[model samples]
Target: MDYKYLLLVLSLSVILILSTAQHENIPYEDVPDICAKCVCLTAHDTDKRYHHLLSCTSKKFQHILARWPEEFGKKHDNVDIVATFSGNNIELLQQLPATNATLTFSCRHCGIKYLQAPTFMDVPFIRRLDLSWNEIASDELTPDVFRGPYRVTHYESIALVDLDLSHNQLHALDRKIFEHTANLTKLNLSYNEFRVLNAPTISALSSATELQELDLSHTAIKSLSAAIFKSLVNLRILNLSGNDLTSVPDKLQLIGRSLVSLNLAQNPIARFTEESFIGLKSLQRLNISYMPVLKTIGKSVFTRLETLKRLDCSHNPKLVEFDLESLTHSSNLTNFDISYCALTTISLFVNVTQESHTDIATLAKPWPHLHTFQSIGNPWYCDCDLIQTMEYIGTEGDTKINQARCDTPYFLAGALVSNLSSQYICNLKIPKQYKAILEEPPRFLRKRYIILTVIVAAVVISVGVMLGFAIAAIRRRLKRDDFGVEPIRYTSVRSSNLSAFSQGNTNSIIVNGNGVANASA
Candidate 1:
């Protein structure tokens, strides 16, 4: 009886364990009190439709269930497109609501650590998903991380368009990580710890052939292979800024025909040769700014980007030489920023009536779309050589003249190039040696010259008066000697008198033939 009773007790325990496990898996009917404040949205565009939104942003919600609240899709079946969950502390994402309604979903800054496979498998209409600023990595991930849920009644692949995984510690990825999503377009993986994009990872994303924009900025990638982006022929925008790339890869020619925008700023690229961007004909906006190590850009570097409209080369203190003529090939170039380069001069895209002179109005015709040109923070020489450039910028009125300052000849230092007087430039046209004399010197120098002249004249006049007195005394002595009786010299008396007269106290003097003077005080 004891044995039979023990078996019954063990059987009951097993039944109880199964029951508790089953209960946890079932979806909850009532909304959690914490999530009750989420705003259920209504369609604003149509006014008749119900479009729902569930925002639990920054709510510090710790866990999510394996299934959404029961009947959430059925009750609000008319709703479409739920979007945005910013600044939350959600740690785990196990599942998503089973509906073709959600179009956009963002869980940025959520501190998410674990995300179960098939998280978005049931939601077939997710267009945009942002999981940025999380602690997501590939170590805890499986090959089927994006696989859809099993035993699904509805069957369709998720129509995910945009995905942002930026600011995460995702250093590696599985080969089949993105295999399920074929229609992904814009993918941003910036601010991550990707050391290199290997062949397996590149192959995984190659299925997304319709990709338009891809941003890998601030990722520490050191090198690239040609086959990495060969499949993305239709890619339009590519941002690889803030990396350790030494040179641009030749593989860029693969998407050269369709690519539009490229950003490689904040990198340590040493030079930009003719082959740097050779085949990118359709490229428009190019940003190569903040590259401290960049020093040289070849003359024909930009000759191929015929559709380029904007180019930013700012904050490169070592880059001194630039060939603006290379940009003339890209007729659509409109916006240009070459600020903080410590440049002394630059050539524009106009014919010279005077040598090196640019006529902004005449040049504006060929490049009708060219409008903004920024050259600020450069050490400009504002002498006669730059007068034409200054005059053109001032007259065009449409051109933007950033705070380009003078840095030469002491007098022009710290003064703005635009504010320089035209009269000063005209005077500078004369030879520099002659121009100094023609132009009035600074007031301090003039005062110094005047004081020195007065001191020299006073010294010369005093010497002249002393010489005149000495000559008159010598002539009187000679006349006395000629008219004397018996040639009496009176040498001793004259010597005493002359010695006393030499002193300024002498009141009277008598001179005899013996070169002496007698004085009475």
Candidate 2:
């Protein structure tokens, strides 16, 4: 029985060894050797779709591979492949490698000056391409450089959704350069050398009807064409900051229906006219801060912005005049930031005069939904009108008043508005109608008055008591003198009589009853 059991065990062991060898002989996909110096990762995107990323950034490579290895896309079915070749010294962007899988290509900061035609012909499924931070000029981009292969004898465009060509030497583009990218949605051309965006140059982008976001900041653009953005009906977000625009671009109503956010900060805009943003009814957030020459925001500048929620006009050193009534038209305004400006005071009533009574009914309620009001870093004049306006706003809404320091009236300078009483802020300037709001004298002042009154009363009482005592003493002295005067007279008469008796003249002599005065007569 032991010999039989050993034979059975040996047979099972041989079967296991043969099975392992057979499994090892089966074909399995491995990482391609062309990406030996690159880091490969299989990660998931925001939609939970798995994709392969090959990063070859800062590898000191002077050239890119002309073609990818065969069977690369056959191994991974329905998976995207993204290849990056950024921060290399490759001066020329030649034909790209072919791949059957959906591909995304990026080659930023490669010092590339030339782009050969038909660059992406072999990469039929290319979706996104990034060529930012290169030296490609306008003349280097041929018309057919972005075109893909034709499908079913008719031109079928590639599936490119995003293209970034920012930070290049491109001054202009051919009107037909982007004809093949009908599905493009986002394009970044910021930090380029566009001094002026002429109508023809802007017309080149009219074909991208689906484009939503465009960045044109810091391009030294002086002005825009009147109808430059009229064709981009689907455009939503636009960044025009850090430019030389002296005023709002004309004819913005062309894209006003679809625009949601606009950034006009760091410009040289002097003021906003009543019709500056007339047709932008869908706008939500606006940033017009950091303008060195901005001065005024007129009364009707924001009259039509009923849907605006946030407004940032901070950091303007010359912005001294802002009509508080201008905000009354925007009923849905929530966050307002006017910090670091030159605003002295903000009042809801129009044409407000100092030292005058304000009717409660006349005061309008602006910013009914206001929550945060940032008024710090400004020279606020904490007068009665300003205090009253703030109190009204605080009571009507849930907005928190910022702790702005006073800069006028000399006495309240550097004092926080929240810590100051309305009476103290207004002092004698408070109107007669609102005198009931004035509080009693300060605690220290009341204490000082009590002390002074007590001292005065004690001095008066002490003086009265001393005067009474002096009068009584004078009366007693008078009585004593009256009683002693008759005796003195009697003595004088007796002495005189005695003298007369001695001189034999005793007619006027008088004596006391009990003690007889013996006369010599």
Candidate 3:
């Protein structure tokens, strides 16, 4: 009976163990909280709007999302998940369902205050946030609200990779804002009022080991110091165009030497020296266009770029000439835009590259392997010298010199600006040298004195004609008996002429009809 009772107790213990295991292993399919933030629900609720953003299969935008702190909502009672309400709509932001909101963004019209301290939602694993065009001040981000920068999100765990805070009213850099974003790569603070980038700002960005691209375009940057970009080792592109930089900063060679594209357009660059791009060995595209004050380009400006391809220095007013003889070895350049510069003729770019997008040769002559040439707005003198260039383009049929319209020389201003076609506004004058020869004949000058001497001898004959005319007039007056009217004016002029003759030809006198000397005559 004892053995039988023990076996019944063992069976009861096995039954209890099996029941506990079943309860513990029950699936979470019935829980409403687990189903709340599922991908399917989030995707469906957002009307499939954020399908690409919510996608985790790829790491394309991983660098931009790592700016926000990891453990968000650690300090506040009401947690927030959705990042959309931070600035755009305060009423809607207050109504946010609030928990695990990873990303947030708003346009320029958002009225969010810049001084709002960091909330619990900012501490979580949230990665990306775009407050572009919002007039947010520089003091809003605090580490206490987000539990510091090193925190992480347990779900979909990954560091943020991208951040775009462009077009904001940020007047200055508060380095603490970026101190927490240690893992970010691409950062865009473009179109801001950032007048200066101090040492703290550089240090904060250098913490992000994966930074690759940084854009500070359209800012109030007066200068770019070497200390600002020293930490970003893997940087590929740095855009600082549309700023007030008068000179290209020194020691930019520290940007990993692998930088590809750099835009320095619309700056106050007066000259473009070859040393301006000394360190960038792997650079490809460079845009320094639209600088009106830029006057000269160093002959060796692009001598070092072996892999450099496209170069655009167009829309510069004072740039008169571009001689590409020194850059003949860099033949890989494909697209070149030197349009609207001070190029008077098409000879400026004879053979700069092997393959180009503009056909500059068509404007003057069929260039050797020339492509798209945007030579316009120069004082293109339409004359016979351009006919050779036109002939080459007409035969090759690939040169697009038709767009290189002449802008100066009043007659050809609006005309179809082809060098070969238009007859240069018809100058009808003879050659100046030939006209001078005709005016100053050697033989005529030699006989000039003789002709004057003969004219003086002919004056003796004129005296005889004047004497006869006077005698006839006197005879007419006697016939008509009209001597009362005095021919004072005629007599005075005749007397004056005779007086001059008497002064030179002395011993000569004028006699009246009765051989009486008329002293007045």
Task: Give the best candidate by TM-score.
Answer: 1
Q: lDDT (0-100) at residue 405 of candidate 2?
A: 83
**Global lDDT of model 1:** 0.72
> All models: lDDT?
0.72, 0.77, 0.56
Q: Tens digits of per-residue lDDT for model 2 on 1-521?
A: 97987887777568546744643453322334755767777776788666888788988767776555432444544668888989988787776766666889999999999876667766767878999999999898866677776453345576788889999998887877778788888888888888977655787777678888888899899887755576789988888999999988877778899998889999999999898998998998899999999999987898888778899999999999997777777788888889899998888753334444344324655666789887888887777777766655553345655677887655567887767644445555633322222458876579788898889999999999999999999999999788565554335655665677797665545466977765544
TM-scores for every candidate against the unseen true structure: 0.72, 0.68, 0.56
Choose the strongest candidate by lDDT: 2
lDDT of residue 135 for candidate 3: 60
Off by over 4 Å in 3: 1-104, 115-127, 143-158, 346-372, 382-402, 407-521
Better of 1 and 3 by TM-score: 1
lDDT of 1 by residue, 1-521 (tens): 98987887777678547744644574432345424645544453555555656665765555443434332446444456665556866777655656756557888898888885557766767878888999988675554445544332322456788889899888766776666667788989899888888776677667678899988888899877777577898899999999999888778989899889999998998889889998898899999999988888868888888889999999998887777668778877788888888577665533344433433434444455657778888877676646555554343556667767777655667887777754456455433432224468776579887898888889999999999999999899988897566755556765676577587655677555895555654
Write the number of the candidate with greater TM-score, choosing between 2 and 3: 2
Q: What's the C-alpha lDDT at position 359 in model 3?
A: 40
Query: What is residue 386's positional error in candidate 1, in angstroms?
Result: 3.8
Ranking under lDDT, best-scoring first?
2, 1, 3
What lDDT is reached at residue 375 by model 1?
A: 80
